[model samples]
Target: MDSPNVLLLLTTLSLTVSSAISGSVVEDLANLQPPSDFNTTIMKNCQHNPSLRYCNSSSVDLKEIFRFTIVASHLCNESKNPNCVHSFDKIDLRNRPKIAPLYLSYSFFWKYCPSTIFSIDLSNTSLKGSFPTEVLCCAQIQALDLSLNGLAGEFPIESFSPLTNLTSLNLSYNYFSESKISDSRFFKRFNASSFIHSGLISYQECFKESTSLTPSMLRAATNGFSRKNQIVRSEGVEIYKGTLRDGTEVRIEVYRDCISREKRQEFVEECKVLVELRHKNLVQVLGWCSNRNKRAIVTEWTDGETIEMWLSDSAPPWKLRLKILSGVVAGMLYLQENWPEVVSDIRIDSVLLTDNHEPLLSRFQVGDRYRNSKKIHWFGIFLLEIITNRRSQEFERGEAGFIEHVRENYPENLHEVIDARMKLPENIFDQAKHGIELGLMCTDQSISKHPGLDQISHMINKVYESCLELAPQNHKRSHGDGEEQQDDQSKQQKTTPERSETGDTVYNITCSSQWIESAPVVLKMTSSRY
Candidate 1:
């Protein structure tokens, strides 16, 4: 039947409830379903179980409609009878076994209703005021249509978190124009039609497209982009910390030398590319502004140290270091696989380290020279830098570089060749050697002789997995002198591994990854002999 007929059927059902129930309930149900023509509207195809009266109605108080129906129809006490079908006006059960389940959808439907609600159609209803938070109560509601109604205020994007089963949502022709949603990840599936005529919802906001920010907004966010707000001055780019009008923290990158027309065009083109790229391991470019001879890109702010600063600050464990390396590699792989171009400049300076020691690759485009250079060979050089703890450029003037250095020193003192920042676990010497060997394989001059990126990733995973397994069982005490040293030796002699500064075992870090991957709760890495 048409939607108008559906509304008419619901009105008739409400009238029936009013006629059967007490005078007070009749008034309440009357409030739910406003006065409508009773002559033309009738419950045409309703099939209610005699013992347990169940019914469905729209254009009524969604919260109080079911309560009124239950009290008026003698289904109040039959809550335990799961097989009992409910009474509804014009609902054909033969064709729609789906609608039979959602007869008692309300605040606590799970505890009261027999079956799950798969869909809810409240279109052209009296649903008004704030967007209903109660909709989340329907955990199994997959398809929702709240169109052609009164829904105001900024829609709570977070309110939909519990409805993991929701597949389709429609809120078109509603009053959500002034509503501002900061994060767009929640509404990825909904198209422009769902939010059409709602001025607040736009393509730039929903898809997280790079908005054209006004010069004034940028200035207000950054305190006029003053030196006080400057976070970093790297590669002729001055980065300043700022917050949007909605209180979103952002990092504003002002190009100090994009004065040339060619440079400005490059910046604009790069912004186009950056807007398309979205990954956890890369900085998110929010928007850009090119006004009054100033060129700047606004991105999501992360209070992270550069890889250069991180390595300089303190020696991190091999497991943590390898995770950072893996993230960098993954980011590069994503760029290579998805985008037309890769992150040409992969170095310590290009990688940012989170507080928890995760890495994010920045500076995506390589500009003029790198765009023309042999790109695939650069990743091998990046790998060599991590293994040798030396910058790739430094290897150019040095004696034989990392590849040759490893070739001469392997099978004997692999420990000495590895970065002194990490003390290799004695139990996994071959694993560590294999990692170094893979790095060497990447740096091979012959392109055919070099290991593929996938092969390199697999080998790194093996080494990373080994480090995770052995790190928990093995503990090393800080080497010192006198009584403190002896005390450390006694602690190291114990079977349990040394706890970190956080007082948690190194195994805690390793276990988090294992659980994240849905792997076995415990992993056992035994000797080759075993």
Candidate 2:
């Protein structure tokens, strides 16, 4: 056959196949049975129990009924409560053994039937994964038993403040990671047995019984605040390495001398804020000393160095850098969501690395009012610092500032500004370009126009995942023949000018059309790089 006829025939066949598949899909969808409303049966049972106030009320909330029925259907064996009747007040599915473990979907407990449910017991249903923070929506709940499960995550201690009526909470026999309740009142309310075998250290255990240290004790620990014991000093704040009487190593942050009434009050307020803040990423405050002449905050000493040292001393791999960025995002999101105040001091020097290379936000200055835009802007500068390995101050005195410099050189001279220490592949370089664009968006001067942490988080995750996918390929390439690798490097440098001139233009057009579009775009870009 001629070329034109052959092409026409193939196109005709493709269209026919597509039409047939479309029709078949439509037919299948039409024949599908609609999901039965489980709420109907629940409502019918409620009608029989007139004694139940919410269930038999004149004005029934169908939304709440729908939510309750959905929750019940998942917990109950046959969509019926243990009493063999649908009930919204209490759901006790404890010790119900099954052939396989039950897996709760993410939406489970997202919206509880408030004022209608009082107790929830799912003690031994083999629940897996983290404790659902959505359970806090059960504001009227008196008793919640999630014991004897495989749930493992940070016990949301700070989140329980909303559960004012919670009289009983049994979290024993689980695999919770940390449960140092910031609220000391919880220690008096709940017995230690409730948290036994959960891998959770009580409040007193995490921070020794004493929450305060005297000035003399701190002085002795730090050798009378000698220069040899000093870690770092900035402004009026000085940090000294100290060891408590019990051999616990710590960092004592002494503020400016408290001579006036206002300074003393400020010291007390700062202490209150530090005591309430607790997360693995944030530096843990063990104790504080508020003397008439001196005020200091002591935090648990972390072993690793600061990010400034990490970047200046050596170039970490792309994967490790992405891990550090992700940790910073997680820590920032936690602070934004849980605390009323904002940490105004976000700098490269403020973040510390752990022995395992985990990033910990070490410095915090809680402001009286929250301004997310300021934090977002600082994070933008911080992200740029990580990408370029250049401090924001480096470009401050130039005609164009840091953000302006990035904007002027992005997609074209992006390669020049990227950290030279860490050589990047073509695919990873695309992600870096996208990151630079995100940083630009975040650093916009308009406070209201900056992207929210949620948006920034989504973009960062996409970049991190793209880097992770290419990590193994890069690893294998790194281990290849040394001479061959050197030859390849030489060839790459020789072609760099031509590639940047032509290949980068096409790549930028493709990427800009779908900038921050979706996860699929990220995957597509990673798979096929210019």
Candidate 3:
């Protein structure tokens, strides 16, 4: 009986030992399934937690960011935070669970915690929220895309006042409506649609040829229309359902001018200089018109307009601003390096605003072209404007605010001049401050002190590199595409209704057409988009 009892005890002990070994093997397998599996287990197990998570908040594997981005969305709640689920070359938010809540708010890019990210794209995700006014968070963001989304409300123009280093932005297909109407007589309340009709919420005034937004003509010859561009009730510029030969919609620009030889000569000279221009940022002259009683310059249309007017009424979100600025810088850099003749004394006043707040480079006539040093100074001033949203010209000696004074006295104090947009998210201020430092370096008083466009571009690119440290992939636009552009705010954005099977899908606006007969030089009409 004793022997039998001992054998039974041994058998029980052996079984216990085997069970322990099997449990150990299972634990090892779970640990080796990659960070993606761990996150999946955590999310599925803890989907209903108070914080929407079921794991320890304290310890995070800071190393597996790359692996996490690939599968975040598949395991995460879709339709809520798309940008967070993916990443780009510059942004990475792997293993960082806390960031999940912030990115979900649809504002972490321009507002909330901008410093926490570098590149953010909430494009066409059917996102619904107020225009993120807090997008003015310091210039840490690089690229932004909120296009094709359900964005409501009049765009907050002043919100993007703080961004300085942004590069690419795409906000197409979103409705830009406002609650307030400055004009209330027509069946439609006076809104941005009065200026532009692409379903975009815009307030920037447009009429000039820029590189930001699509240009629209305000009026045709009407009893020698007064300087006032306000179109009377029925006299509003007409739009219809038509197509250009190339399948591109037909938009005309009418030129009606008074006989003035002096103005005509000036126009001719300006055109001569304009034709000399060759920069990626510069708009291509679609065509021109000069007649006995009229003179006009027809050029390729832009998407948006100047920074000032775009942000005049309200403000754009912060990330959008940065995207605009980056594009502007690329254009400016092109002018500063490849074509100094373009940027030097080209068009200070002609720097029109776009509906989207991007600055358009227009009227590039060689009027008092600056030397190399002055070129650098202007570049810095422009950079300061990009960063702070303050008028560099306003900062004469003895200016009131410290920002303007810095531009006056130090000129390199770009950081000091920054617009008080939203503060950078958390510690991201450090990067923003660094960006300002670079801006200051770019705008230093000394020519040698100032960074050239090439150097500046490199540094700006570095900002993108750093931004990748926080943001995820797919939250940024492709780099070096050279597609970023500004609008000619001088040209309004207006659209007319037309039936396209289901509903009104086409609104063909007429851009003002300039006839060669307008130019007294008797040049042949050889261009396509005149």
Candidate 4:
């Protein structure tokens, strides 16, 4: 299971699949494995159920560096030729999904190209031929690893300027004279260490020259750092998905060894801390794996909408907006009142809403090492996002973010940020405005003055509670203006007018006393008397 090492995993999974299908009604696949192709090596673990086929797989191999080498041999059929150029616009490698070349192996896969892949890995390949100079075309190249290769000659500066987007450049372990590139005008702007491990100011390059043209061979040859999977799962946890002796579907997110030891340990500590909280508003962290070899987090994946998607997509109506914000406040309050030590990093993407609109907060604090003003900024930003439906990053008018809306016309008509689908009840219009004012206050540029998570919760509670007390129904439109909202109240008034067990009338406000033939005033009931 380590790095999935496809050559080995294919054999193992095939046998497992064959055995699994025979034991239970569920069918497994060992015979369905496909022959390896230049694009991918698919070893199936398929379970076909008339309508569909399900399969799970781990990626095998990744280009430590993706680049090109100069070919001394004519086998170097230079298709782009004499040019020795390969376009990133041509490497269609990611489409295969299941296949990725590791280290120098990626240097072997330059046939299909991509137009915009900057970060490439071509380490650990003894690719001969001079370096393919044309890959400099990838203007967006940032991190490139071409370490541990057989490359020589003066490093060219013209080949690098096109890749101005680059930040981390690695060209260690090569044949070039260290002093040459160190003093060369082209390599001077970058750090001396970027050309490490050689007599020449060395840089990594592609394994193959143009004997056969490929997409990314050149890019990998330049930047000499490995581009392996950096996102890791937690440690000590096994990814279980079969039967558990019982009939239930086993589910788990196992940790992978991609994260640093420290972060993994922090993740584990956070999991341990979160396990102590029993609140329903906070997501339950069932368990976590924190062993040094591997690390990962295991929390239930709620099958509903995320707050960002909910707002940006299928936008719910105005009433629903209040309801959602209310749920968000209730959850935050529960966390602060009970688990303030751990809950932090409250941002729009971090908060989720269930199908019923109950909000659940995630990515809370587990370890003390990684919490601070960022947390306040995050929580305040979350509230600001809910109020403005604009990301906090856009707060300044520079990017036109949520707060920018208020900045353009605040204390004047702050309703612009409110969801167009929602309505402001007559009485709580002020409260809604007040809440927005608080959001504007909370999302201030001066981090020092921004409200804390608890204070944000308080502001929302105060604004909403006061608003509800005054308007109860949440809006103030009459039959002509608020007829749509009053429909719900009208039903409630007629059905259980007073919440009576038998559904009795709650009020006897005589129309005769209020209505005159010439001027019948609509009874503006201040609050729900029923």
Which is better, 2 or 4, measured by TM-score?
Answer: 2
Best model number under lDDT: 2
The CA lDDT of each predicted structure is 0.53, 0.61, 0.40, 0.43
Candidate 2 TM-score versus the reference: 0.55
Please give, for residues 262-316, the per-residue lDDT of candidate 2 as tens digits.
8777767777677656554677766788867778888888878889999898788
Backbone clash count for every predicted candidate, in the order shown: 3, 0, 71, 78
Clashing pairs in 1: 54-86, 54-87, 55-87
- TM-score per prediction, in order, is 0.51, 0.55, 0.40, 0.39
- Model 2 spans > 4 angstroms off: 1-210, 223-228, 232-237, 396-400, 471-530
What stretches of model 3 exceed 4 Å from their correct place? 1-280, 303-305, 312-319, 336-338, 344-359, 393-404, 407-417, 442-449, 468-530
For residues 1-530, what per-residue lDDT tens digits would candidate 1 score against the true structure? Answer: 43322232233455455456653222343345433543223233232221111234333233343443333232211222222233221111111222222332334332223223355655545455777665555555676766656678767777787777777676765787455453566666554435544455765554444577887998899898788888888887788999887566888988655377776776777777776665546776778887547788887788898877776677665666677767776676667677746463667777788764668876767333443124435665566566557664556755247566666765355555666566544444334444554454445443333444554465465556546435443535422111122234323322222344544322211222221233223322111221
Candidate 3 at 186: error in angstroms? 38
Error of 2 at 84 (Å): 54
- Position 262, candidate 2: lDDT: 80
lDDT, candidate 1, residue 453? 53
Over 4 Å off, model 1: 1-204, 233-236, 258-263, 366-376, 392-400, 447-449, 470-530
